[model samples]
Target: MKEIKRDLEKFAAEKFDLIIVGGGIYGIMLLLEAVRRGLKPLLLEKEDFCGKTSHNHLRTVHGGLRYLQSLDLFRFRDSIKERRWFLKYFPEFTGVLPCLMPLYNKGIYRKSVFRIGLPVNDILSFDRNFSVSREKHLPGGKVLSKEKTIELFPSVDTNELKGGMVWYDGCLTEFQGFYIAALKLAVQMGAKALNYVEAVGLIRQNDEVSGVKGKDRESGKEFAFNAPVVINACGPWSRDTAGIFEKDYPRLFKKRKLLWNVLFDREALSSHALGLRSKAGFVYFFHPWKGRLLVGSPEKLVEKSEAETVAPFQKMEEFIRDINEIVSGLGLEYKDILRVYPGVLPAEPDGSFSGRPAFIDHHKNGGVKGLYSISGVKFTTARLESDRVLGRIFRHKKAISYDEMLSKKEICCHSMAYDWQPNGEDDLEILKKIIKEESVVHLSDLILRRTSLGDNPPRALAILAKIRSLFDWDNKKWDEEVDLLRKQLREGFPNQKPRGAGNR
Candidate 1:
């Protein structure tokens, strides 16, 4: 892969077709989509790519299994389409994941509902395996016998446990590396992308948005890029970013909620990603990610400011208690949480997450022309959503399929390389190449965002010195970066009390 070449001068010099703000999944996909249609696009990120909410997912790609609840065939097909896209295109980065939900005798969580539901789902998604490789192919959902469910999940709560319904899904195996790979592909296809550059404001001439006004966070130097059109795909901060449009700007979010997943540092509970309903009737999922039990999706209305993404301590305690209650003998507690991936997402007034992706053209809204905003709650359909947004722009040229690039071997940065190392550090050659290309602005960029050493803060701290030789930082600069990375880790993984004895 060619170096990401962080060039501010080149950014200011180029006159682009589109200027995309926000380097999260949505923004990155939009940038790639623009390029695929032969449009020159410039993408800017305030921090490293996927540094915030995008990196906080459970890494499981949903295939609209829940949409079956309401018989939403359109969504079911759309989800299966995107899930298949991820599997077929990025074969190295995506994988088939079987997800099981423990069945109960009563309520909607029973086998009878899914027996019909699964067949309908399978029939609608008949084309799921079209063009997909054999290894990545998804199997039809099935109803497991109660004895089989007991065999798989030995400690499951048996109060009314009938059996289980297991469905297939996809997951990002490379974590943030998938984000980085798509970004690298965009850059290779003649798109310009820069990290640590903030889009401060929009440059509007009359009613048309001329371009984006940007500032380098490291140097405090400002620059402007000219583009006829601009898009705001800035996840949680999208509201704040588009706030510049002022009153009459349509409300982007009806409501907001704090969504988070906890990476419990315990042995994984099952081979298949498991879902179980608590006594409170909230269905919680347990994902087996990189040997840890990744449990998630506890949500509440946005009580705190959007910036406070760290989940509340009391809420986390409650989440742990709920999980423990679902499976007997699985006595988990707060300290068992090695890392908590938290983010803010748009929600409905009743606290249900907004299902649809929203994209707005300001000109249509009677606001600034040549400017648009997009916010999507789910990551699985980001590419499809971007294609829809850009399909409106360049209507003639078709969006390129990622399957086209299958013949070529693209460069990928495995962010979690350190995790697999027998020793504490990654291979020196791999680290050297990452430092040379992938825009290494700080130690935290490499440790946290670029490589997932940040997933386990304490482990990242332990391996910090081992990789010190990769950076050219002097004593003082090195110490400063280390301190900053430590502070960031502490904030993301708060309440670092040790796991109590016999708590497992």
Candidate 2:
């Protein structure tokens, strides 16, 4: 990975075939594809890679079973293929998750209708041995008696209980970990990827894109890199950045909006993801990971101005209440939530899903012949989306075959291998060591992002302090980081009061 960084720095000093703006999953995936094609690609991120919506994911590599309702067969097929690909290539992170769909005596879809849909889903799996009997990891579709339903989901309301259907889907244990792994792979393949570099402008000559101008956010120094092709894979921010180039070519731009939400710790209701019909829309996937449960609302169009807006606090609270009311076994409250995040989904103005099918537009009239844009793909389909975008950018040539790239394997970039494991008895000692080494401040960052402590927050502070004691930092550094974290907590979480204030 370090070698790839050095090579990228060298390429940036000269010229490159591709300069990709945005370091999220889309940008990183493109960088990987380009470098594998022997194209020296430079990737820039305004913040840490996967720091935005990529980090905030439902963690399910869905097979698009829900899309069957909309009859969006193309997306459904692409998702299933990609799910299989990820499971095949990265089995360590991806796995088949058994899901239960508990039915009520009074509900929308009947058993017969679901039975028909189940066959469609099975067909979409390409006859690849996903049957319940063949795949024991997944529960087969069966109607359970009321007594059996209680055994299956003990917490479900018995009064409304009917039998339920069990099925299978794929899940990623950690979305951030997956992206970070991909980033490491891209670096290994000779892609230059640097985080915290903000792209400020598009360098053009006579209305053609020549390269990009950016500033190192950490150092506040500006730098430039030249490339014939520049890709805008900035997710929600793609349109805003593309508009800068579109200013020179007024005829080539449009925008659209999309919204998603997350609800945590509500997964105790079912062993696998669940789908339910709600008055608002279809509620799919009550996904459980580690200890938290996540639920998402359907994707609906919103105004561009409200694109980045999050679900209101009250609305999120209501969502939690409603979900709890629907799912018998799961019980949660607003206080159970750790955080709420919102991101935009970009699209075009023609009332079509601009990026859903992986929209790619080339701007040759303005001098930048290789400038391309990719938008509208969910996490499950990132690999295929990247392949599609790169195919368009590379003019439909096989940039680098997947088999060859996987065959030349040089490194194993697994986080679990490097992460600290505590001897059951020495957990305190290990925790202290981690805190000391990382100089952790806020309990949330320590537990949530850094370690698994946030999942069980009651012991987070003590664990944090223990971890901190292991580091040999001077009192001054400790105090500084603590102060910085306090300020961050105050600003980032205005509602939550500081815990154990006297500890400071």
Q: Global lDDT of each model? A: 0.80, 0.60
Per-residue lDDT for 1-504 in model 2, tens only? 233242234545878778888877788778777867778778888866665656556667777777888898887888777777666666556667777766764544556667677777776666433322233233335555667666766765556556666667777764544665566667677667766677888887765668888777757877888887788877777766776755332222245444444545333455656666454555566665553566765344566575244554455556667776776446665555544445555556664445363454655434355677766457677767777777767875557666677666643323332123443556655455434432233333344443434333333334445455554668787676555444432222224433422145
State TM-scores per candidate: 0.94, 0.80
Residues 1-504, candidate 1: write the lDDT tens digits: 767778998779889999999999999999889978888999999988888888888888888878888878788788989998888878778888888888876777778888998888888889998989999999999999988988887877767678998889999877667777788888888889889999988988888888888999989999998899999988877877888543323356767788788877787788888988888888788887866788888986875354457777778878888888887798897667767778888877777788898788877877888888999978898999999999997778776656564356476646453354425344767767777888889888887776767676567777666788888889899989887776666554446643321121
Model 2 segments more than 4 A misplaced: 1-11, 105-108, 127-145, 248-267, 277-284, 298-310, 328-331, 346-368, 410-494, 497-504
Kindly report the root-mean-square deviation of model 1 from the true structure over all alpha carbons: 2.9
Error of 2 at 218 (Å): 0.3
| TM-score of predicted structure 1 | 0.94
Q: What is the C-alpha RMSD of each candidate to the true structure, in Å?
A: 2.9, 5.2
- The whole-model C-alpha lDDT of candidate 2 against the native structure comes to 0.60
Candidate number with greatest TM-score: 1
